[model samples]
Target: MTQQDAQTKPLTVDAVMARSGVQFGTSGARGEVVAMTDQVCHAYTTGFLQHLAGLGEFSPGMRVAVAGDLRPSTPRIMAACAQAVRDLGGEPVFCGFVPTPALALYAFGQGIPSLMVTGSHIPADRNGIKFYRPKGEVLKEDEAGMRGQVIATDPALFDDAGMLKAEAPLPEVTEVARSYIQRYVDHFGPQALRGLTIGVYQHSAVGRDVLVEVVEALGGKAVALGRATQFIPVDTEAIRPEDVELAKGWAAEFGFDAIISTDGDSDRPLLADHTGEWLRGDILGVLCARALRAHAVVTPVSSNTVLERSGAFAETDRTRIGSPFVIAAMNAHLAKGEQPVVGYEANGGFLLGTKLGSLEPLPTRDAVLPVLTVIVASRPGKIRDLIEELPPRVTYSDRIQNFATEKSEAIFAKLLEGDKDAQIVRLNEHFGAIAGAVTQLDLTDGIRMTTEQGVIIHLRRSGNAPELRCYSESDTVEQAKAINEQALAIVRDKLA
Candidate 1:
């Protein structure tokens, strides 16, 4: 081999992913922790920086912000990313273990790129990295650009096992938590949450302590509960049964006005009413958007249709299931001169696309905004009161884990075969028993069927894991839950 060839190895992100099995998911690049070696993460971060550099969003000697969740493997992976930043002639500013949006806000304010080390509510054994350009989160196009780049690296930097031979320590923490807290406090005023009693279920979320500080700064009585030593994977989208019971018991014991929590990375939120019933993400989105007086709203197809039924916003749009798609739609609305535009997911991650008064647009999934907005909007009433004011539509969702991606694709292909009429017939034949007579089908993100009785049932494969997700909506919460359960059962039977 030539001397130059030995020193300069050309590697693409696709090649690394093929060999390491750590590929991009719905949001970011994710895989099991075991496969995310130092070399793999370094390559991923380098590719991200390379992509940004190409877009003129990054340059050598520029600063890059980095942060991570509280997962065990986060520190090591973050170290690897920091080393990559240094190796590429950029400075790494460690933001400590803060929420994803906090890091994004700081980086965007500083006009630099950022990377977050988090699996985002997934199991602790698995982890992921979310990349951000200077302006906002990377869209689908940026992801493709990262994958196609041929990164140059020296093989001697990593051992045969892909571990860095000599990894550098992460820099000291640069506190972004204060700014994040102040963002809400300043917007809502110091006494915005005065006279309210809130129970914050702090189950190992990266932003747990920050949540307490924010609540207190807003003059609310914040009761911190359920602080765990070990990492807890809390999926705000799929609230665990134990968490539900815990919220109920806590509410009863404490007589709180509301109970709020966040997922592992603290991007998606979990807000339970005074009675201990957790609100659905789409429901939370609707309430938050209404509270913010948003002129335009964009959400995923799997979200509840109440955004339209509530008649709150001047315009509402639905996109495919993912933040990237939602962000893209929100951007379009902004380009069209829509004021105070916002977007959210079915998982309660609120995204503000346009500046509202003093607050700037973050344009990423945020946990605290929706919870805080909903609580403040409730005022003297409880969280349930704000929920009751919305349209009488309920949505529920659950997933079947360990379901292969190929199997999910096959099911979608079979259901979406032929023309729209033929697709409707297939959907009715499969789900008629549970959903009455299917009248319409929406193939936006997945297969969403609307029955004649105004019931909605949506089936979409999980983009972050090998899970098949089912969502249902109806007039009542009971009916929505029942439909979700029955749909999952039918999908299971089909898989069998």
Candidate 2:
């Protein structure tokens, strides 16, 4: 049957997956919203929470927190989820209009599990749910188990009337944002940010005002600009050159030291230095890892090699491209009595050092800590100075191709087969000798090949968007761009 016809039929978990293309990731679950309706959210959340309840993770009297971003449909989806949690014999606590990290912090602080409704910088129409437990982020295996239950059950078995049972109003939780702001204040001192003029572009960011508050708490002038009630669909992964130029003009006009903004839920950060040049998110991740003086850094293969070369980390572990993978690796290291000083993503969210009295690092992405790292690391000089002190490694990333929703994953799978397709063989040979070793292989998330030339090329599909992402790193910025261009040429010729 056609995809539309299948979707119109009664919604099964399998049907939802097939229709919406929902997939499990390091983050709880993600998929296109066109296939994710209120019914889909209700069914999957109810099934997953019920499964959790069955496992005794939460009892009937236990409370669960719910939060979401500024996306248009977030409220509806969140409501559906909250209702589902209540129906599963849990109390639903609604933390209205908070960033995903804040909600995760609240969940850890309250000693209750939580759920966040967000699409994390995807388009306005897209939305997904992320789950957190007291221990840390939910594991990918756990999510896969939940998905299995969801798909195995009959959609018609859900009690539509029973699911609508009324429950106590969502209780107001104390503002966790204040606590996060205070953490920065306590660590960096209130005067640490003095003399820095920071311009914050508040374009439909759920954490816009909170970011401004953090800036002010640090003793910096926080200028809020481009405040938009309408969704701007800002993608933190791929920023346009024009946006960088615009930020530069704004910094010059306002005499600002830096420009910073967050993705929709304020989980992923976007930053520009004093020169108004937007740094790649992976680069920001490296800088933050360095500032934290992490002994071991956990990041995805999509990250830059400079992370290892910075001399800031004794070891670096690469994982699939997602917060869940990074967080899982960090947790494993911590279990072995090793302190996980920092965990981050090519997207700009940095997980802080996990410790007591410190919030449980949310499995979801976070933008605040990364920006704070840059600000705090400035020390005696402005952020520009820190950038100057770092090695001149440049990384370029862009999503150059689009695929039909179903075909995207298939194309990536084909690339991983590594047959002697002329284009694939040529790229394999060219980049096989760079950096240190040539490994012609497929990692979990995508096709990543390392070379002895100190360059790495990664081609993968965006979990949260409809495009394919290509990442490359080199000694010079221009050279990085050139390599990315060549890689894109190969992808086009092959995927075409």
Q: Highest TM-score, which number?
A: 1
Write candidate 1's Cα lDDT for 271-367 as tens digits. Answer: 9888888898989999999989999999999988989999889999999988999999999999999998999999999999988877989999999
User: 132-222 in candidate 2: lDDT tens per residue?
Assistant: 7754677776666566554232334233432323332445654567776676677667887788888898988999999898899989899
TM-score per candidate, chains pooled: 0.97, 0.87
Worst 10 residues of 1 by lDDT: 1-10
| Per-residue lDDT of 362 in model 2 | 47
Cα deviation of 449, candidate 2, in Å: 2.6
Residue-level lDDT for 52 in candidate 2: 72
Off by over 4 Å in 1: 1-9
Estimate the TM-score for candidate 2: 0.87
| lDDT, candidates in the order shown | 0.90, 0.72
Q: lDDT at 13 for candidate 2?
A: 50
